[model samples]
Target chain A: MTALIAGAASTTFGKHDDLSARELFRDAAEAAIGLVSLTAVDIDAVYVGNFMGALTDDQGHMGALMADYLGIPDVPTATVESACASSGTAVSRAVDAIDAGQADVVLVGGVEMMYATGIAVITDALANAADNEYENEAGLTFPGIYALMAREYMNTYDVSEEDLAQVAVKNRRNGVSNPISQFQEEVTIEEVLEARPIAPPLGLFDCCPITDGASALIVVSPEFAANHGLSPDVRIAGRGQAGDTLALQDREDMGRTRAAERAAERAYTAAGIVPEDIDVCEVHDCFTIAELLAVESLGLCERGEGATLTTTGETAKEGRIPVNTSGGLIAKGHPVGATGVAQLVEIVKQLEGRHPNQVPDSAIGVTHNVGGSGASAVVHVLEVAG
Target chain B: MTASWYESFAAAVDREEPQYRRCAACGESGLPPRQTCPTCGEPEMIDAPLSMSATVVAATEIHVTTPKFEGEAPYTVVIAEFDENVRLTGQLSGNEDVRPGDGVTVGVERREDWPPVITFTPS
Candidate 1:
C-alpha cells in the first residue's frame, strides 16, 4: 500500500525572475511528468504547495492553477500550506490518499515565487510564518530567531562560532557539486567566520537564500507503478508530521526543536528502521545551525554531537552520513514551499545513483523539513524498493 | 476569552506595571496570553504580575530585519524571564553585547494604532 515515487524533477532552484509561480510549477511539473510514461491526463489527484503567492506573486488558488497549467484542470486539487513545510504536507497527504485506496497516479508540486517582490517584502512575507502578534511585532526575524537558538545552544554546549561555521563550510562544499545549488563555490571555515553578519553568531553564509523555484514529484500506488512498468526503485517508506507552539518563546527549550524530534520519531517508527540505517539525508538546512539541530532532531547523532559530524567532515558527500548532499536548503536554495518536495527529489536522485553529488551506495534516504522556528515539521523516509 | 489580553497587558505596561498569564493549577506562565493554559490546557488563567527584574535566557543581534523594522538593522532580541518562569521575547533596548544569563528589565511601549513594542533594557 506504499506510495511509490516514480518520477521526480526540479527546475534550477535559484532565481527564476523571468518565470511566474505557476509557470515555474508548469516547467517542473512537465519535466516530472515527462520522466514517467504516464501523461498529465492520467493524474487523478493534484496537490500543490505554495506560500507567499498572494503577497509575492499576487496569485492565489495555486492548486487549480497548477492543474490547469498541466492541462488536467478537471482533477480534484487543493493548495496546502504549513509554512515552509507546505509541500512536505502536500506529499504527506498524497501518500495517505494512495495508501487509503482513494486514488492512484497523484501529482504533488511545490513552488514559491519570491524574487519578484524583492527582499523587504519577501522578508515580511516570510515573517508571516512566525507569530505575528509577538515575534514579528518584536522585530524578530528568522535569522534572529535561529540565532537565539544557536546562542543558547552554544552557551550550554560550550561550542564556539568556528564550530558553527563549519556547517556552512561543509554544505557549501557539497553545494559546489550540486548543479541546482545556489552557491557553487566552496568556502573555508575562516571565510565563513568572517562573512557578513546577518545575525550575531550567524554570518550571512549561515542563512539560506531567498530563492525562487519549484519542484515536483509523481507519486503512484505500488500497483500503478508495477502496472506501468515504472522505475522499480525509490518508494516512500515512511512519513510523519507534527506541530509545536507557533511562537518560539512558548517552548520550554529554545535550543531544541521538539517538533522535529517528534516527527522524526514517528517517521522512523513507520519505516521500521533506526537513524543509523539512513544512508543519506536531505535536511532542512535553512540555516547552518539548522543542519546541526536537524541531524540531532533526526537522531542521526546524539544531542550535541552534530558539531562533531561537521568538524570531522562526516556529513560531507564523501563522508559517512553524507548529509545535505544536494547542497541542502542552505545551498540548494529554499524556495520555502518548494523546499520539502525538492528535498525528496534530491533523495530520489541519490537513491537512484544519479545525483550531482551522489553518495556511493546510498540506498536509504531521509528528508527532514521544519516550518518557522520549529513550529511545524515533516519527516519522510525513502528507500530503494525491494 | 483572551481577546483583551494584549490590550490589558499593554495598558498595565503604560501604568508602569506588567502582567503575564499564569496557570495556577499547573504553575505555568507565559506571555501574549493564550485562551487556555499552554501547559495544562486549563480554561482560565490568572493575570499574574511581571516584574522589571528579568534575566536573559537567550539573546541575538539581528543584523538584518523585516520591513517593519526597516532602517533599524543591527538590533538585538532576547528571551528574558521574570518571576514564576514567565518568559517574553522582545527587542533589547541597549547593551548590544549582552549574552545569555545577563541582567535586564522589561520595557514596553503602548500604542493605539499598533501592537505594543516590548524591549529588554540591560540592567
Candidate 2:
C-alpha cells in the first residue's frame, strides 16, 4: 500500500534566538501531531534527520533525545544522516517502513541548529560531507565546489554573472510573501551583481544563511490514515534516491549531477509522471547555482537551459512552472538537516491551499534534495488528492 | 609526527605512494581506500601513482576562505581528471586564468595548521 503524508509542520526557517534543538523539534512535532486526530502514542516509530547536532551543539543520539523529549521514549527510533539530504532520506525510510508493514504510522523529524557554532566549526562540520582525503584535504569548501560548477556552467553555456543574479532576484521576490523566509526583502539584479563575493562568481547573497529550525511530518499508510479520521491532501505517489562517488573528480560530467538524474528517473517512473506533470517543485538551492542545476537535473529543463529559464522568468511564481515557492534555501534559509522535510512541508501546504505563496491550479508537486555536492539525492513526487 | 602543513602533506604523499588499487572490473582508481569498487562493485583490483599530471576538468576562485584558513582568502580550487580516470580536487597554483582541459601537475604547499596540501600547478 502507498504511504500518505497526513500532516506536516515546520518552525520558521531562520535563525531563532531562543529555541533549542529539542524545543524546535517539539514545536514542529506538536504542530504536526496536533493536526491529526491521533496523538504521538499512535506513532509506531520515530525517525530524526540531523547532520551536525554533535559538533554544533555537542548533542548526539538525537533520536533518543528527541524521542525522550517528546514523551515517546519506547518507540523505535533511528537517526538518518545523508548530509543535507538527511531529512529527505528520513521521509524515504518512513515510506519504506509503512510499505513493509513494519509500522502503520511514523513520525519523521529533521532539525538543525547551526547558528550556535563558530564559522570555522561549521565549515569543518560541513566539510565532513566531502571526501576527507581528497576534497577537504585540498581545502575545498562547499562554496568552492559549487563555484567550480558555476564557472563551468558559465563557460560552457556563455551564461553571464547577470544571468546567475536573476535567480537570486527572482527567489527574493517570492520570499516577500513567505513569512518564514529569512530574506523577505526583494533584491534587484544590480544588488545581486554588487553583493560581496563569497566565491568569485558566487557572491555573499548567493549563499543561504546558517539557520536554526526543525520540520516534522506524519506519514501513514493510506488505509491507516483513513481509519484514523485523517484525510490527507497529499499522497506520496513516488520516491527515489541515488548515491554517487564522494569525489567530484570521479564523475564524468562536473556540471551535471548524475545522482539527481537517477533519483528523478526512478521517481518519475514510479509515479508514472513526467516533468510536465509537476506544477511546482521545492529543490535544493543551498546556493543560487544549485537551484539552476537542480532545474536541469530534475528534467524540468534541458542541460544548459537552467540559466535560460531563470533569465526568461519562466521559473517565477507566475510563470509556466513555479520553483521554490518556499523561497528556497537562498531566501527561506537552510538549516541543513531540516531543509528536506521543510521542502515537503512547503509542497504539502501548496497542495492544501494553505501556502502563503500558493501557485494557482497546482496539483502535482516534487521535492529534490541533494547531499554534499551530488553524492546523494532523493526525489519524491506527490499528488493532490481529489 | 610533526603537525606542520608540509609534514602533513608529506605524510599523505608517503601513505598514498604505493601499489594503488585500480578496480580491474570498473577501471576507476580507488583513492585513500575503499572496501569495494564504487563503479563496478567488484572486489578484484590491480595496483597502479595515479598520473602525477592531469587535465583540469573544472576550476573556481574562492573569494572567502574558511575562517580557520582565512589567511588563504582568494585561492583557486580545481578538479582535475587524472589519467587513471579518477578525479582529484585540489588547490590550483600559478596563473589565475586556469580553465577546463588545462594540464596541471600535483605539487605540495604548506598551510597554517596542516602540512603541505596537494596542490596543482598549470603544467
Compute fnat per model: 0.90, 0.72
Q: Candidate 1: lDDT of A71? A: 94
Give interface RMSD (Å), model 1: 1.1
TM-score list, all predictions:
0.97, 0.94
**Model 2 interface DockQ:** 0.57
Q: In model 1 chain B, where is the ten-residue run with the lowest total lDDT?
A: B1-10
- Residue-pair clashes per prediction, in order, are 0, 6
Every model's DockQ, to 2 decimals? 0.81, 0.57
Q: What is the lDDT of residue B17 in candidate 1?
A: 80
- Model 1: what TM-score? 0.97
The global C-alpha lDDT for each of the candidates, from Candidate 1 onward, is 0.86, 0.85
lDDT of 1 by residue, A255-333 (tens): 7899999999999999998999999999998988888899999998899888887888888888889899888887779
